[model samples]
Target chain A: MLRIAASGDWTIAHLSAADGELRSLTAGPVKAGRAVIDFSGIARFDTSSAAVLERTARLLEEKGLRVEFEGVSEPQRRLLDKIDTYGTPDTSKAPPAPFYIELVERIGVTTREIGEEARGMLGFIGTVVSAIGRTAANPRRFRLVPFVHHMEKSGFDALPLVCLLTFLIGAVVAQQGAVQLRQFGAEVFTVNLIAIIFLREVGLLLTAIIVAGRSGSAFTAEIGSMKMREEIDAMRALGLDPMEMLVIPRVAALTVTLPLLTFIADLMGLLGGGVVVFFMLDMSPGVYMSRVQEAVDFWTIAVGLIKAPFMAAVIALVGCRAGLSVTGSAESVGAMTTRSVVRSIFLVIILDALFAMFFTAVGI
Target chain B: MAQKGEPIIEVEGLMTRFGDHVIHEDLDLTVNRGEVIGIVGGSGTGKSVLLRTILGLKKPDAGRIRVFGIDLAELPEEERRLHERRWGVLFQDGALFSALTIAENIQVPYREHLHLSQELMDELAAIKIAMVGLRPTAASLYPSELSGGMRKRAGLARALALDPEILFLDEPTAGLDPIGAAAFDDLINELKEALGLTVFLVTHDLDTLHATCDRIAVLAEKHVILVGTIDDMLRSDHPWIHEYFHGPRARAALAGK
Candidate 1:
């Protein structure tokens, strides 16, 4: 019979044949019945290994041999009891052990899944492009409800801030223009310069930037929340065209509202410039108004209004597009909303410059 | 009983691949009218993907899906929209609009698909809310104000707003207490009976399966291993089935019986 030797560390190492002399002295003989399994140094037992010990015990019992546990540990005894309660230890189909390799394989699989999901974004972009084309073709389907809501929320509601911003900008421009004109004893020319510049470029640009920051971000957050909650999915399931139901209304609303807001911003800016001329340049309201009338033509105001719809379209498109890009995660919604604001502002500025150049070339 | 007519939803050889990995392969399922079917699987088992594919949110690389006899792959965008108006879905977490009141949420389907007066829409919305067992006072509250179970009930109210014949629910009782979950199950059973709706329920809750499912399809080993009643599942010879049903929770539930 083979027996384990105690190593004094609560763990027994295998007994070698050279240790037979000590084994013989301890047990008086090396017969199977005289062999005592010392579990005194054994610790940290598991179910599978405990099963092997139980099997050995059963074999010894069947042979009419008494196996004694001289110093069996309490933990080892508890492990054995657990094994008994839990039934068989079928270690026949145990999995392979290289844990890091399995982890890497799982990470690779997840990475591939995410990569595929990102690639699917291109399909969504394509859908957006097709939606835009369809909207252009059948403008009638783009209903007035979203447009009305957006106008009230994004345009009409934004009037106070737009007016205040334009007024401040007009005052600053007039003051600066007055400083230079004063040097030449032509301070009244500041009125014409401020009015012309505002109607031509500053009014529309300022209004667009405000909308890009305000309404554009609002659209992103709203849509992003919907995407996260799967309301977008519910809409699709109900056979509702999400673009028609969600996007078109926003686009129409911004488009209708921007032009109206721009008109208001332009008027406020002119009034602000007139006030500066009246106070700083000491020009009368009549003289300043007459000069503005002479320098700032209908064409300048028309050019500014023309840019309004374009700016509105850009803001709405960027906002809605970023909103649609949300992927039903809280982080994704936040990230996409930020992207919407950045994209809207960037597009608005770039388009403003382009319109400036175009109108400049056309001698507007 | 399923009639001899076409199934409401038919998915054949549904294979969806994301980049180099395949989510599912050679999958086939048939959902008939007026049948309540439950789909059960571990997390990340493509159950949600399967539902999304049926709704045309995802286009499977190699498969055909037909909803209400209209082949999704073959239908044009207009036709797809027309088919979409016939079904309803209650997403996981209920997915109610946070900005809208419960009544307003229910009014969404009616406002989009039908040309009804504001008074009529309000009346219908109220009726739908009442049908879901929500109080009239709760109708004016926003989704953020509602509890998890209430949100789900409100979402069900919205889904029923269109009088849809088919309803898909994804994890309807996911975050509720057991008592609340059982109550939701009772609501589902009542609604199904009253509306004659064909329900496609996706969940991992064993209690939900034992209580409400007429038949359950278990996804395991990258395939559907079993589709049967609770008794059949308990008696199954499969190792996974034995392990699942003999677990502590199942044992406790059985012991109480």
Candidate 2:
């Protein structure tokens, strides 16, 4: 006798318990003349349950058994019929491309993005330069309040952190130079090492990198959110120039403050170098101060000082352009803000390098 | 097809409070098998709080919540999960995992509960995506790519993944346009009957209540003040209910019926 039996809820939760029983029925008793499938004990049924029942019926029929579904309710049959209509859905996902192809694709995409961004940045420069020219033509049109507000936030508020960071870095450079000079029996020359490095390069480079991280990301996030909320579009609709109202003030604030911040950073760095070498080496604080003072009088200090405003302009322009490029969504704001910090930092380092080569070539 | 229609869920003397603000007091509700119950309330009335409390997401301050003839609070963790597997809850928003595709989102519960092959799980997910009225191509799309209406449908598909006998919907029609809302109503009604489900729907959409609910529970003054049909709600003298049913938007909803 070919007897098939199913009992229990046969719902998704209870289907696991019924799995072994169903599997046994599907594999056992094939090539039967007649089979009786009983569903008398089922209390609950759903699409999954119906799927199991329909799977069993098909398996039996494929085995050439004349299947009889006993106690099959109308609702149960209807659900089974529903599943039967969409016999098997296509669930195939596209396979990922090969490694080299993917790598090439990534390189192409990155190159294209850099080119597009370069163009966009140039366009932003054109707009802001014209806006500044107009503001210069009529000084009354300049937004002094917003410019002061941004300067207070990005410059004055950044003092303590910049001082502490540059001071600590200068101390580290002095201590290490002293240790290395001690091996050469010329520990006194640690003053030359610390003075030349901090005044010529480390101080302003560190300040510019810090500004890129702090002020650049902040500006991008702020203006990106405004763009995301259509506030930029609203300002345009109201005939207020975003370049004047938003961009000019931000750029002006950073340009004015970054050079000042860089000067403060150089002072604190020299002070930090003096303190460290006075403790670690035979050089007196007076001698260390003399070397640092002489270095500042040369065009070396001027090179670092001049790089500050240019780096600030780079950070400000990148941040504002990235912010303006932001489409609607939190994701866009996040991506463009990150891009702002990265691009500005990269450009700052490259600009410092070019300035270094120029100073050498020009005998500064 | 045929159920005993026994009381599947019973809550009595329910109390809920957030800090000093009391949300529910001396509240009682019973959900019978295979019936759609709508919970309606004003803006601050805690209709969602009650639903979340019943789903065990929030702890009720004081109450007796017996589901499937067992005290939920007293049951062992494993034993309680067995009872929990009998129902599914859809949140107000889709709440689909942001990083996962629609297929992966639907497969999450199966991956947790079932020992099936990935191929079978994918097939089941595809079925669910189709059953909830989404195109087959939607399976590969992420939740971020979907519109608000499509996201709700995707959430419904995830809710239906386990084929539970009870479905808990939180504002299923909240953001849908009129035609979309009506089609959703029809879909819910059809699914409830076809799958022999007991639906507990919390909604602000007046049309959804008219079309899908067998009984409406009005929550006011920190309790379910009344539980009855739309006609009964219309006939009642409760101040809020009177204005709610006779209000301009309510009249438009009723006329659209």
Best by TM-score: 2
Q: Give per-residue CA lDDT, model 2, range B24-85, as digits (tens).
A: 99999888888899999999899999998888888989988877767888888998887787
Worst 10 residues of 2 chain A by lDDT: A13-22
lDDT of each prediction vs. the true structure?
A: 0.76, 0.87
lDDT of 2 at A7: 76
Give TM-scores for every candidate, taking all chains together and pairing residue i with residue i.
Answer: 0.46, 0.89
Worst lDDT 10-window in candidate 1 chain A: A9-18
Taking the tens digit of each residue's C-alpha lDDT, what string does model 1 give over A72-114?
Answer: 6665666455434433322132368698999999999989976
What DockQ does each prediction reach against the true complex? 0.01, 0.51
What fraction of correct interface contacts does each candidate retain? 0.00, 0.57
In candidate 2 the C-alpha lDDT for residue A9 amounts to: 74
Question: Which residue ranges in model 1 land beyond 4 Å of their true spot?
Answer: A1-364, B1-6, B253-257
